[model samples]
Target chain A: MTTQEDIRSTTADRHGFSEVGPDDTEAYVELQQSLAFTRLRSRSRRYLVSMAALFLAVFAGIVALMSWTSEPQGGSSVAGIDLTLVLAAGLLVLPCVVTVIHLVYTRRRLDPLAEIVRAQFERSRR
Target chain B: MIFSLIILLVVSRLGRARDTCSDFYVGDRTFTSRQNGLALFGTFTMMTSFVSLSDQIAWHGRRGVLLAAGFAVSWLVTLLLVAEPLRNTGRYTLGDALSLRMRARPVRMAAGTVTLVVSFLYMTIQLVAASNLLALLLGLDGAAARPLIILTIAGLTATTVYYTGMRGTTWTQIINAALLLTAVLVLAGALLVYYRFDVARLFGEAVGGATTSGRDLSGPAPTGHRSPQPLEMSSQVLTVMVGHAVLPYLFIRFLTVPGTRDVRRSVSWAIWLITPYYLLIVLIGFGAAALVRPGGLLASPDQHSPVVALLAVELGGVPMRMFVASVVFTTIVAVTAGLALVTAASFTRDIQLNLTDRRDGGERHEVSVARRAVVVICLLLAGVAILFVDANLTFLMSLDVTMAASSIFPALLFAWFWRRFNTVGALCCLYGGVAVTLALVTFSPAVSGDPLALFPGADFAYLPWRHVGLVSIPASFLLGYLGAVVSSERNDAKYAVMQVRALTGIGAAEAVTTSPALAAADGEPGAPRSRRWLPRQRRQH
Candidate 1:
């Protein structure tokens, strides 16, 4: 087991904190948070089920496309491949627009995760 | 310890090794959003997709690239949910999240092990690609493939880890990104010029004329390499293309950028970057399709693919040949660098954090261990590449992609979005998906049949008719989610809350400047030193 100093004490600063001392208390939080990223206790079944369902749904669609097309038989474009090229060429003028739109929608959902970390960090700092 | 390595590596590198270890591997938090966008553009030319997508287009007509488009969508998925959250939640490595959130050392170890193993397989593809290109260029016996690849690229990778570390890798990738763009434009432009600018007409002609055996071309076939049908998917094809393409090496590449927004932008830009490159590959494939007709073909056009041979005829000179060779070489090198760095970082960060996170005082050991871990991981990749250089590209990419799609992608997605996701679920789903897929692939009639059998009949199809992806991709996700539910009984709400905060970008990191030589717990634990590295205090909370 590592003793108190390796992690318990704050790491030395290169140009020593200009106007700051190593916050020993803040230092303790780092030790805890570092573990926070690495530890994996377990998961809830419901979540796993949901992920499975989503994977299945998308996969089934891929299969449906495969079977529905009925072999790589003809000179037909499967999976909307023809359309993909069309869209890709258009994006040359505007690379990030579509992805940006989707990212914004998801950002709201993810932003709250950050809030939780701040709240925990603040409380622990006390 | 990494900072020390960076100091040593500045010479061989084209750029400064000024970035911190995390910055070198994951990019400095300061990596511009624009650069991140370009970085994605450069790196996402995944190995699995290269041949599968190209062959699909050759056989299935233009719709083949739909698979490519499907794979590309993941980058967008990354931009929206994963880019910022993954960047925000952790400082280094996938193991960081596992250890930090669960406080489980074993879990971090398990994740790190998977990362290293998967990377080893993925890296082999790049090494083999380099070897093949060199063999083609040098006019050497194809049998010399393994030695050439090991001597050149392996030596480079080992030295990279020893010297430039992550900084060297990033700069190399950046240069490749630039060269790849120019190469793509050049080849695409040349093809378009030859076709008189009507790509659609060329496609229509290729599709209209495509035959089962694309054997009508004039070029000499490489000896001992012939299959009856051009469109056939042998068992080897299924394994390489589907399995190898989606592996973690590519997925992990996104983290090389500095920040979330940059990653987001990079993801978006990646689509633009790779889209044309692949689309141009179609033009190249169609050129082969057009030039190499059935019945008169000397070799299946896919083998020669006419990209290189045609360049000689079209440009009619040495400059063009050199350019073509350089472009192909760069593609291999760029990809190799990306794969090697991903492996190195995963080995370093994952093992370092796992050993130290549980123990309160393990920072220095963690750093030392991470460096040593990189050495071991790169060597392992070199060994695997040496053994498997002759395996068909289609088989290699298939196995790599399918496993990645089934396992790593699901884990990362759920880890980011699925709140209830737990380790048991992730493990079960990933292993189940991969196992079932591999078994089906084993009995794939096309692959199991003798290469020169008179009848070529199979006992049973075993696989569900076609592309094993249809089954395994979903199976993996199901197992992961279900595994989570089973493990939910050991619910750790506080841990979930912490994860949620991290994903939301509200997490804060205590700025660490330099680690002391030895801590106070030691006989003479040095007092904490200067703290110039801390970010200015802000009300982020």
Candidate 2:
């Protein structure tokens, strides 16, 4: 396993932002604390937390809906299927659709923020 | 028997010379999203889902539908909470991922302990179920035949894992998924045709038939002696959803995907495949309840025999039975192989490698150690399965899921998401959560006085709830929070790096090019002509 210092130095080299020499460990620490990195961290954290909250709310809502509704039994039929069966099918499919939408939306929204952070590191190097 | 032999041969042939740790562990991280998706689907729809869901649905009516629906929700949990971040960590095992920013040795040790415990318990269930089914099919019922059947199944599972590693296992899972989906689709189609594709009539007949046997289809079905309350039903759903989020085997699936994006896509694809499969499960359960008479066709109405009976009736003749049996057999082997591989991988990569300082022995040595670990772990699990052959399988499965939810889920969630989560907190969650879960389960009614208890004669009942997830899951999170708050040690910088990597996929492990053909096409400098599979550690760090 690499030391923490080695990891930091390696990351700096990859990002094209090793303004500080490898020997200047304190300067490297300062680089990680730069405003750009701080913003990157804060934005990503906010995104993840918000996504988590949204998913939890949706999941809880589904559970509550199931609990509140009367059990599907001997119900009216649509194309020979019971109403309850259709409801269960909808419940099963809803989360899956939500997950796909969430992933696509999050990827589109967050990738650019990651790029901005990377560009900032490069700008600092120049 | 012929089908089993053929599957074993195919899997064995595919296990050709995985010379590097990356190849053995993650298939050189070369699996595309679709391939990984299929494998994930295979692992997710284990024999438990294949056999138990239909059985539960047939027995409990709407409650079984809810149970199946709850399992579908688990994939959503995996996608929303676990998959992307876990892939971003870019570690081969959960232990490696958790220990990335925390104290390495202790955290790795604790993670490895949880992995082995969960894997062993889960694998034992698969093995015992397969052996029991095999014995029943062969008309063998004596105590003497049971161990022999277990040894045979375990030996086959171990051999597959020992030789194939991840690459072979991936292909095996793909094949299993295809076979399973085909069999299910055919049976489901037959059922639909039999009912003339009338959904209301199908369910109406199911409810009618089930009610004739003194079982309620409109509400929660009787479980042994007691009907499950709404709270207990909800708890089961919660336990399954949370339990799947931290299952060690599922974590390895994320490692197989190339990047966080592919990981997310892979899980989405898995859910797409699984949602329809479970809808079919609901259909099959209802079909079984309606078509197969309660006590006429099957010896016991509640057993999985109804599914076989349904297939026998719909498809007709002995060939149908053999075909359905083959599908079930393959499900068992594929799932058990995947389980054993994860257990062995964790044992080799996390516990053995981290505990010792001799980490310099190249990829070949590590792969060798992994193969040996696979054999050792399989043998140990088989021995334990032999001892508990008569134990209630359902209770054991509930215990396994509860353990994962109460112990592993909280620890992994905090380790990845919470900034203040430290080594002390990780260990506290691991040991404390597991200890409390085991103690509660031991005294709970499920194990103490229930007829399904491991020792039914002994009476030590105290706890009211059969499942401990309602309490243990919350208690675990609290314990982790308290431990982190009290700890004086802080590693903010390391945590910062972890957070960045996990969120941005920066400094994550890259896919190594293992195929010489691809490497040549890419025009790499001084690349080896022969097969050279090496870890991308330099780039990853």
The candidate maximizing DockQ is 2
Tens digit per residue, CA lDDT, model 2, B1-541: 6756876767655545467777678876777788889999988897777777888887776777777877888887788778877887746887777776666778778888888998998998877776666565555788788798777767877787787688667776877889889878988888888878887788889888877877766565454565556677777878888897778888898888666777877888898899899999888888888887766434653343445445455555566666776777777777878888898888877788776665677678778888988888878877988997766676778888988898888887887778788889988898888888899889977886767676778889787777778888999899988998999756655565666657666556777656565544423243222222222222442
Predicted candidate 1 versus true structure: per-residue lDDT over B1-541, tens digit per residue: 1222332243253233333554345433433445555655556653334433454555444344444444544454454445555655555566654444333444456666676666666677667765665555444675665576565666655565445455455544555577666755675677678779877666555544564454211111112233322223222233333343334554555554444445555666666676567667666656545644543233433342333434344543555655555555555555666666666666655555445444343444444454566567667767777776656544544555666666666666666555576667656655666676677556654354533221245545454333466567667788887878877423333234435434433343332332333222212122223232222333321
Return the lDDT, model 2, position B287: 83
Q: Per-residue lDDT of A5-124 in model 1, one digit per residue for the tens? A: 323222322211111123533433353355433331122224334543554354334433442443332434435333334433332222234455445644554334433434555565
Candidate 1 regions exceeding 4 Å error are A1-97, A103-126, B1-24, B46-52, B142-146, B208-247, B291-318, B349-368, B445-447, B450-461, B508-541
- For each candidate, what is the lDDT? 0.49, 0.73
- Mind giving the per-residue lDDT tens digits that candidate 2 earns over A1-112? 2246544533343212122234333332444566766676676677667876776676666556545665545435567665556667876787677776777766677667
DockQ of every candidate: 0.11, 0.28
DockQ of 1: 0.11
Q: Which ten residues in a row have the lowest lDDT in candidate 1 chain B?
A: B215-224
